[model samples]
Target: MHHHDNPPQSVPSSPAYIRATWGGTGSVEEASAAFGFSRAKGYDLVRRGEFPCRVLRIGRSTRVVTASLLRVLDSGEPEYSGTRDAHTAPA
Candidate 1:
């Protein structure tokens, strides 16, 4: 079994715009960046069942649905502050 004791792994931060173009399976950082949040925030959201479940895993990594993230962003209509600005908050 996978060790639940170990903290989750992280993905490299990719450009949000490019991530938006990816269409599916985004790294956690890519999704988080689209939401204008830190990777930690993304994990927290996942813990809270706010983000899409990981569609795939590579080694110690997780990949989320880019389409889901984009749909989320589109539905939320965030201002794209790239920070925790309530005005820029995702729907």
Candidate 2:
């Protein structure tokens, strides 16, 4: 018989992990996880223009600005300015 004695590792916060891995930008999924939101809900928020920060649309790709995410995390208030580019399109 053999016994396993490995301890469980502590999980890092979503925002911290996203910031470390993605640097200045991250996907909407990452942003949603950072704020403890479901991926579906996150997409819904973006679609309804109710996301906490500005969501950028590049082609079919959607990315969240890390600066804005960090700001909202710090201040607990959204600062969206409704700056959608011509190329902006929903995912």
For every candidate in turn, the CA RMSD to the true structure comes to 14.2, 5.8
Residue pairs clashing in model 1 are: 76-91
lDDT (10s digit) by residue, model 2, range 19-78: 666777788887887788999998988777778987787899878889898789878999
lDDT over C-alpha atoms for residue 11 of model 2: 40
> lDDT per residue, candidate 1, 18-88, as tens digits?
45357567777767776678889977665444554333446787677665555556566432222433444
Winning model by TM-score: 2
The top-ranked prediction according to lDDT is: 2
Q: Lowest summed-lDDT stretch of 10 residues in model 2?
A: 7-16
Model 2 backbone overlap count: 0
lDDT of 2: 0.75
How far off is residue 84 in model 1, in Å?
28
- The per-model lDDT (C-alpha) reads 0.57, 0.75
Tell me the lDDT of model 2 at 80: 61
